[model samples]
Target: MFDIIIRSATQRKVRSGLTVSGIALGIFALVVMGAMSENFNQTFENSMSLTSDKIRVFAESGMFGGGLTDDKVPDVKRVPGVKDAYGILLTTFDEDQMGMSGKQIFALPPEKSRIALDPVKLKAGRFLEPGDTYQILVGTSIAGEYDLQIGSKLEIHDKNFTVIGILEYTGSFFDSTAAIPLETAQDIYNLEHSLSTIFAVPEEGIDSDILAKRIELNVKGTSTLSPRELQEQASQSLLIFSVITISSALLAAIIGGLSVMNTMLMSVTERTREFGILRAMGAETKDILLITLGEAALLGIIGGLLGIGIGSAAVYLINLWLAGKGIILFAITQRLLVVALLFATVIGTISGLYPAYRATKMSPMEALRYG
Candidate 1:
């Protein structure tokens, strides 16, 4: 039976190849899109780890809406269960100052910022120091995008500053920001004592939500959120992207399923006389059905394996290209391969059902006479 199925498929190489290609393309789409989504979720979770035990305090209105004063920092620190507090000043630079648009500038107190506690490893040079007034640390993304390197000089708000370090990518917004001493940021932006946000770490064994609420109540005109809340907000913002990715993959699978059904139906029609001869030679209806299903399953297994290899290679090349730009957008895993292959096989088996049934229902005499 297996030899018959193989011989039949090989006799029509062009049709079989086309059908396999369709299924492979569909599986490839599913694997690639699913891998991208997984990568995003993992990266988001990693970024959240940094703030999991901390609370973010920002103006009740918005980050850009009037912000908060430095005075709020002391009040937040005094809140119950608070371990430490620090302020961050955010400002944007003009196109001339930034050498491009949409880049953000962050002012963090060298001694008090979270980065100083467990510093991100520097790709070059060093982190900011207390006495470093005009020195800045650039995120990996900013450095790659602007072609900036250690010792590079940048003019911001008409003041010259030297790039003293490049930060490693943290899969977070920090990867795109330029950081300088809080005092220097204030002086450059003319923000005498204003802050964009505050970061508060909870005392050991303290609940982050409780600490956040305490800070919000103690410090008026400010809102506070735990790391989990921030992660939920980020997930909501990416909902649309996720939906699109899933929809495209599903559509491809449906198209591939239809192609398989068409190919199987055509193959059954062309093999009517052969099936008739087998039936006359004492082959049962069940045997013919199994042979048809076996052929479809073979196509699926081969196509799925090929698809996994091709999809994995594609993701690797994409990551290599994106790495130079300090970004990662895909993560292919072992589980993804298993699920993709299983999905392809199921789709192939289901698609072959109608054709297999038709082949069995045909009258042997009628098929022989028609042939």
Candidate 2:
């Protein structure tokens, strides 16, 4: 039976090749899109890990509203079930300064700052100490890109600060940012006594949602966002990625399936007398059905394999391009490859269903009399 299917496909090389190419194109899209989405999710999760268990307090009642007044940090700490809280000052430094285009900056009190940016191990020098005015910490990415070292001076807001530390490569968003003392940042940004956001941790076993709610109800002119809320937002964002991949995959599949169906339909028509001969030689309906479906599935399998090879090469090239920027944003995993192949095979078999059924329904004598 398999030999017969192989012979049939080989005899109709042009149609078979076209059908396979279509299915392969669909799988290629599927693999490429799937890999990109996975890489995006991974990067996003890594960046979010730091605040995974903490809640963010925003002043002015909206998630991205105006900065919270510096005085709100103590008030938030006093809230019941609140274990600890710290205010963070986040902003973009002058792009022209030090050739850092829109460099992300985070500032917190040297003494109270527990944010290590990925538990950020230090590569050189030491972290900022209390009362260390005009001091800064730089990530490995920035240090390498700018040739910065301990004792290197970075000019921010018309003031030069000595780099006290170079953080280890964290592969997260932090790698592109620099850290500064809280007071220094406030003075430079002219945001005296103002905070971008507050990070709050709940007491052991305290419900984060309840704590967030209580903070919102008690803290006047403030809004609270819990980790759960962040997770929900992440889900929504990831869903967009999924929708994009799935929609493209579906469209590709449909095109590939139609091609397979057309090819198989033509083949069945051309093989009427051929099927009649097989039936007269004691071939069963199921045998004809399997042969037709098998031929289509064979095309699908070949196409899927081709697609995987092409997609893998594309992913490799993409990663190479991103490597220079300290990024690896595409990956083609084993599971994704397996799933792509299975999907291709299923699509091929399904597209041949009608034609296979039609072939089985033919009367041997009538088929023999016809073409």
- Clash totals for all models, in order? 0, 0
Q: Alpha carbon lDDT of residue 219, candidate 1?
A: 87
RMSD of 2: 3.5
Poorest 10 consecutive residues by lDDT, candidate 2: 94-103
Off by over 4 Å in 1: 90-106, 114-119, 122-124, 139-150, 154-160, 168-177, 189-194, 236-240, 281-286
Error of 1 at 127 (Å): 2.6
Over 278-360, each residue of candidate 1 has an lDDT whose tens digit, in order, gives 88998898899888888887777777887778888999999888777656678897888898899888888888899999999
- Measured with C-alpha atoms, the lDDT of residue 33 in candidate 2 is 88
Once superposed on the true structure, which residue ranges of model 2 sit more than 4 Å away at CA?
92-103, 112-126, 131-172, 175-177
> Candidate 2 residues 37-69, lDDT tens each?
776676567668756778888986553466588
TM-score of each: 0.84, 0.85
Best by TM-score: 2
- Candidate-wise lDDT, in order: 0.81, 0.83
